[model samples]
Target chain A: MRRDVFQAIADPTRRAIIGLIAIQAMTPNALAEYFDTTRQAVSKHLQILTECEIVRQEQTGREIYYHFNPGKMKEVADFVEPFRQLWEKRFDQLDHVLRKIKTTKK
Target chain B: MRRDVFQAIADPTRRAIIGLIAIQAMTPNALAEYFDTTRQAVSKHLQILTECEIVRQEQTGREIYYHFNPGKMKEVADFVEPFRQLWEKRFDQLDHVLRKIKTTKK
Candidate 1:
């Protein structure tokens, strides 16, 4: 099955995993400590993330660590950024209205 | 099943639906025209979008228009913004290194 960033992040656990790995690379066992789930469950999430290239695995000293791939996450950020800008513009307009009201009252 | 913004946007078609309505409120009939699916399928997608409050419906005479809810989308933006900032910082550091290399070469 073809997986994408959206599908990879659809689960809250996956999102948490992304947040954790984005800060630092971690093994599945290490990552499982942060959640109430088992290491196997965390590994499953890691698999989905890896499928989408959202997280990459590196082997060092007989241990594997999952690292965040910001390039893949760029697809998500790019999708949300335009909407964020649109909402910010709306908020600015609302702020302008409030400022105008305050001046009128004064 | 509980739905959130992430779940609402998991599918490519749903994301396209959001992009369309974000520009302007659209009826299910109008939305169906943009897709190869039936109106019922479009309604199902709309139902999921509404369940998560990502899109809201407004009744106008006999028509119900789906409007984008920016507040709900804030959750998504807030989650992605920090990671985007982190990657941007990394990119800036990379730029610094590249500039130093260029300067040394010149």
Candidate 2:
């Protein structure tokens, strides 16, 4: 199944994991030290993130470095872009209406 | 209960509702006409959105106009802004590293 970007980011732990790995590529062991949780938990979240295509692994020798996938993140940015603009435009419209209402009242 | 911004946006219906209202304030009945689903289902989503503070209801005569709460949406926008930047930065680093690797190989 293709996991969606929204569900992948639903969990707080997963969100934290994304933040930790986004700044720099990290191995499971090194990544786990940031949180109070066990390495297994971090690994599990990584698996889910990988499935969603939000995080990807690169193998260097025996070590795996998980890095942020910018292309995958473009979808999320796309999801939010319209909503952001829509709200701003509506607010501007509302402002104009309010101003008209005030002028009419005056 | 304080509903979080994450779960509130997890549903496609909720996100659509947000988009609709973001462009302009809408009533539940008016909003329902946009979808094939029942008005009650749309109303339920409106309720959840109101609880999360993402949508606000305005009383105009007997009709309630549901408006997008831009302040509340700031949280969702905030959650995404950093990830976008981080991923871009990391991708640039990866590009640089890959170019170096190519040079070494040649």
Candidate 3:
């Protein structure tokens, strides 16, 4: 089953992992070293991120390098954009309505 | 403790709640009726969304109404914007480098 991008991003460790890899591509071990958790824990987080397509991994020789995948994140932005725009428009309409009410009140 | 916006958005039910309220404001019970779960369960989900500031509530007479809070969600967008831009720039740079490599090979 496919997971929603929001569900994929809900973990603090996953967000931190995204942040680390966003700065520069790094081998899984190198990324693991920065956190106090075991390498396996980091690997698990990376796996979820990869499954979500939020991060992509490339194997070069013997090492796997993880990098941020911005295109995938555009999926997230697209998901929320409509709602964001809707609320903005609603607020604008509310403002107009309020103004009208004020004018009529006076 | 402050929760990351990503962490706040990670649940499917929460995302669904966000979607429902994005369309129109509704009372907690009215929102609960749409789901198979108990009202208390829905209430719990709404509590989390409210805590994250992703949803806001207003009491009208005897009922509380829930509405989407767009301004709070801007925080999530802002959090991810830097990383998204960074990756796009990196990918553009990579494309340039790849073109140079192709020309050199030619």
Candidate 4:
């Protein structure tokens, strides 16, 4: 199943995992070392991330390193772009209003 | 209670509501007309949005209009900014690799 970037990032733990992988690719074992949770739990989070393609695996012979795939995050940025534009416009409007108030005071 | 923009946007319905109000400020009655759901249901979505302050309420005399607050969306954009930069860097690396491959082939 294709999961959205939002679902992939919904959990704080998953978000942390993404953050870790973004800095450096790590094997499942290496990635698990930083977390207090059981390795199995960490593996489960990786599985979810993998399913969403937020994390990609690189194989070198027997070694599998998980790397963060930042491109997948575009889904999120695309979805939020309209909202962001709208927000900036609102801020501009507010700025104009504030300027008008200052001018009136002056 | 303060809510993160991620939580505010998790629901598809809520996202749609945000999109609607972003274009134009609308009252509960007007916003409800677009959905198949009941007026109360639309109001519930509006309530959740209002609580998060993503939809700010403007009261003029007896009229209450819900307007999309674009400022709140910065949380989502901020959280994803690092990931976006990472993605772009990776793309540049890929482009470099592809050019190197072509040069080698030549």
Per-model fnat list = 0.46, 0.32, 0.46, 0.52
Tens digits of per-residue lDDT for model 1, A1-106: 7499999889989988887777678999999999999999999999999989989999999889999887777778767766665566674454454344334321
Taking all chains together, the TM-score of candidate 1 against the true structure is 0.81
Worst 10 residues of 3 chain B by lDDT: B97-106
Measured against the true two-chain complex, the DockQ scores of the candidates, in the order shown, are: 0.25, 0.24, 0.28, 0.28
For B1-106, candidate 2 gives per-residue lDDT tens digits of 5377777877877887877776578999999998889989999999999999988999999999998886677666766765554456655445454444334321
Q: State the C-alpha lDDT per candidate.
A: 0.80, 0.75, 0.71, 0.74
> Model 4, A27-78: lDDT tens per residue?
8888788888888898898989998899988998897889878788887887
lDDT of 1 by residue, B1-106 (tens): 8489999888988988887787678999999999999999999999999999889999999999999876777777766766664466675555454444334321
Better-scoring candidate (TM-score), 2 or 3:
3
Model 3 chain A poorest ten-residue lDDT run: A97-106
Pick by lDDT: 2 or 3, better one: 2
Q: Any residue pairs clashing in model 2, and if so which?
A: none
Off by over 4 Å in 3: A86-90, A93-106, B1-4, B83-90, B93-106
| Model 4: CA > 4 A from native | A59-63, A89-106, B60-63, B91-106
Per-residue alpha-carbon lDDT of candidate 4 for residues B6-105, written as tens digits (9 for 90 to 100): 7677776777787777667898888888888888998988898888888889997887899877778887776776566566666455545444433432
Q: Which ranking of candidates, highest TM-score first?
A: 1, 3, 4, 2
**Candidates' TM-scores?**
0.81, 0.72, 0.76, 0.73
Error of 4 at B2 (Å): 9.1
Q: Which docking category, incorrect, acceptable, medium or high, applies to candidate 2?
A: acceptable
The residue-by-residue lDDT of candidate 3 on A1-106, one tens digit each, is: 6465676667767777776676578888998888889989999888888888888989999999998786677766655555555445656555454444334321
- Specify the highest-lDDT model's number: 1
